[model samples]
Target: RARSRGRRCSVTGTPLLLCCYLAYLALGTSVFQALESSAARDSKEGSKSDNWTSLLNYTCLDRQALDRLIRDIIQRYKSGVIFLSNTTSMGRWELAGSFFFSISTITTIGYGNLSPQTMGARLFCIFFALLGIPLNLVLLNRLGRLMLFWVQRWALWLGGAQKNQARARWYAGSFALFSGLLLFFLLPPILFSSMEGWSYEEGFYYSFITLSTVGFGDYVIGMDPGRRYPVWYKNLVSMWILFGMAWLALIINLVISLLESSIVLCPCSRRNPCRT
Candidate 1:
């Protein structure tokens, strides 16, 4: 009777959790819309006003010519060629830059900072992604397992007995989460802020966005054409991204494990009365 009641409770819990998740999403959407919609509208109006003022001030070019020039500039920006400086020999399609793009693509980050402009390149990208994404996942899984093995070994070395191994594993997971947050989240932002000349908050935002694979593309590393970067800089960032993703996967697995354990161990359910 108890086992059947427990199973019933577990079955019902799924729907309850789903409802809660949906509600959370709705709340977030409402908050973001309330906060940003008006600001976005104002910004669009300001941009139009500025463009009109610029059109009026420029007597050398007619409106049609100015419009054509603007269109050309926008097209060049979209093609990722507008940022290239005359002094810099590096380009978006350089060998190092292409390698960075491949890493981002396989990791599913898709920063949108650079993309294949030609149809042939685009077709090749499509095929590459189909295979590369799954292969990246496999690599991440193996890296995560290797990390977990070391974490478990560290937990055992900390004197976790056979009976208390589960508790030790939980502690180890917590430690790993803390370490990952420090290494990937906290430390990297400081370096990015110093190197990219961004505010600390912006650096932190970029770090979180990139590692989470949200890839908003508002701020990408090593994209400034005006400044020279080390030849190995992009490669180093790519390695950081790959390892950070593996760490993120491990953290997600730990969280899911914790949630599952909590659900299973919960004493109070629809079928099971809470003991005070």
Candidate 2:
């Protein structure tokens, strides 16, 4: 047989990864669509079939009966015992929610403030995560390595033509760290502040929390009531978050590589791995 061009799985991984992702995308879209559709139907059904409507229409009911009916309905509405929506407001599992949930799951940020309330969605979330997390890890690791290669070349070039190698390397590390912060942190907050109508501080906090994957579950995007945004707006926000996570991975990988190199170069490293 002719010599193989590369590793046995080199050709296989790309197609396998593509297939896995497509399957997840198709399956997840179908499942979440179904779940959200059912929820919408239920909410509409409740709104259509509210008990108060019959009570208000019935002529035979006395004042006491009407008062009791109003009291019960008011209590239900206040306690979240009923969920009603007008034409403008979408249900919890509408398109925006579906997009948000998908991003949150893959990122493992799990912003606890919003989740699928239905059993089908809960079960799906569990298994989908089981399968998707590995795919995420592998892809992120590969991307991190690719980014690290470029970062090292840039750093080496920047720090070159120096008399002291160690000082040059240190300078390079500092450059990478500063650039990563500026790219991943400082710039995005400005756009976010304007788009989300948040103050600069809140925008920065949200950006930092999201990229770090801390996901305290406090702040989220596109929550403005009675405001209509274009379809591309929310979709773009989701894409931005995913891109930021990839960039964050690159930063972490760069830092780790720098640390390892520093340890190797340290005068004491030849004697002990942990000793300073």
Candidate 3:
């Protein structure tokens, strides 16, 4: 009974943890939106102030007068003076933005494009990552097993190896290798390049670097100055990063699993060659 309970908990752990993460994500989105919106408004007001200040210079007003006015306006908004709003609430820290940050933290990607500016947020991130990393590891392993199970089942049916365990394993492993390469590595570059207007080489390079978690912070999506993307579009990119990390984890674990099982000869057998 205890073993059965253990199995049940293990099976339920992934979804339960996922639900909590999503709930936390929802709360973060609401709070950050309010914070970012206020910041943007203040920034817009600051720019209007700056433009007015510039007019003083054109009219040859006293240098001291321009300096005093600018200082007073900046001191009023405080840190909003630095946010530099793009006239849109398209902050680098929105719902999808926070979601991406959460995913990157859990996956150990650490893109560093966006980070917590406040001390409280930084401390919270530290604790969140401490717990979230282990949960992410467990979830990735479970996902790998689940996906492998279905892939192997398909392979067995296709190869007519339903009754043959060894043949099924071989066929499934081979098919999985091919499919994993196509789905994770090859197709993504092409798809990303088309959607983000990146060169094919740049797309492939970004995909490789991101999945490997090197996170150089060179290329980013939806950051075009001339073009603004929809909210759903940004969210979709975050979803892609999450799923791509899962697939990468699955492939790495699958390879490790294979290596561990590959050594067919036991230590006892190796020492008793005369028995063979």
Candidate 4:
């Protein structure tokens, strides 16, 4: 992999890039099973009281919506499937269990366990989401592209045909638009409605509103004891929202690439010229 990676970079001596490559190679597959087991334990111990302390709580799910979330959590817990969490728990074992979970939540993979609870934390999340989201996407893209270049000896392998830099960018943008719709519009409603027992429209509306950071508190995550997940769940939801934002940034980049390509492909006007 190191030799393969070296051939991909045009630069002969950039140590930082090499370090990133090394990190990617090192961290790619650490502890999938452990994360799942720990999350399951947290779910089994979940409670009505813990909702407000979530790292990822939002105001859209309301009581009924929250109840549905709780059911899914409990169901998953009972089924003994592994989920993700980033919360610090009681013991050293539990604290250590949160190691990978914290990494995922902070980076926004948001397997859905640990999250923020207080208003101050949520407010901090808004800032963190904006800044951290782009960082994650850029890093993910670089890491992904590096891996592709290493293994395939090409920029893009199977996803699509490689084009000029501009065309490649446009292709990426299309992916962005598609993903954005799925994340911002489609997935939220499906997840919310299922968890909160909300109407699909209401779920979507809340998704849109909360994602936009409007925070119309007409509906909220923990208002219903019957519906809310444990504190861990809400915290994870916050992490998910941030991850959603990072995905959104990828979409934006894709859109910009597409527009740039379209302009390049078209005949030039007086105002804009295609640079050779």
**N/CA/C clash count, model 3:** 0
- Superposition error at 195 for model 2 (Å): 1.2
On lDDT, the stronger of 2 and 3 is 3
Query: TM-score of each candidate?
Result: 0.77, 0.56, 0.58, 0.36
Model 1: CA > 4 A from native: 1-22, 48-72, 80-91, 160-171, 257-276
Which scores greater on TM-score, model 1 or model 4?
1
Candidate 2 residue pairs that clash: none
lDDT of 4 by residue, 1-276 (tens): 444443433243346546656777667544655677778768756744465436226656667777788799888654435364431241112443345334444465443333444588568767876787677667756654553344343325423565465666556555555756786678767777767688888977776655544555455443343554456655656655565554555555668667544533333443533333
Across residues 1-276, which tens digit of lDDT does each residue of candidate 2 receive?
112422333343446556767988999999999989999988878866785466667757766787787788877654434345542222245666676776678788776545766689889999988988788778777766766677777667766766566777777767766776787678777877777677888888998888777888778776565456567767676766766777787767668667544533332323343321
Please give the lDDT score at residue 214 for candidate 2.
84
Instruction: TM-score for candidate 1, please give it.
Output: 0.77
Task: Give all candidates' CA lDDT scores.
Answer: 0.79, 0.68, 0.70, 0.54
- Sort order, lDDT high to low: 1, 3, 2, 4
Q: Determine which window of 10 residues in candidate 3 has minimal summed lDDT.
A: 267-276
For model 4, the stretches where C-alpha displacement exceeds 4 angstroms are 1-155, 159-172, 228-232, 249-276
Candidate 3: list runs displaced more than 4 Å.
Answer: 1-91, 159-168, 254-276
Writing each residue's lDDT as its tens digit, candidate 1 over 34-62 gives 99999998987987788667775866787
Most TM-score-accurate candidate: 1
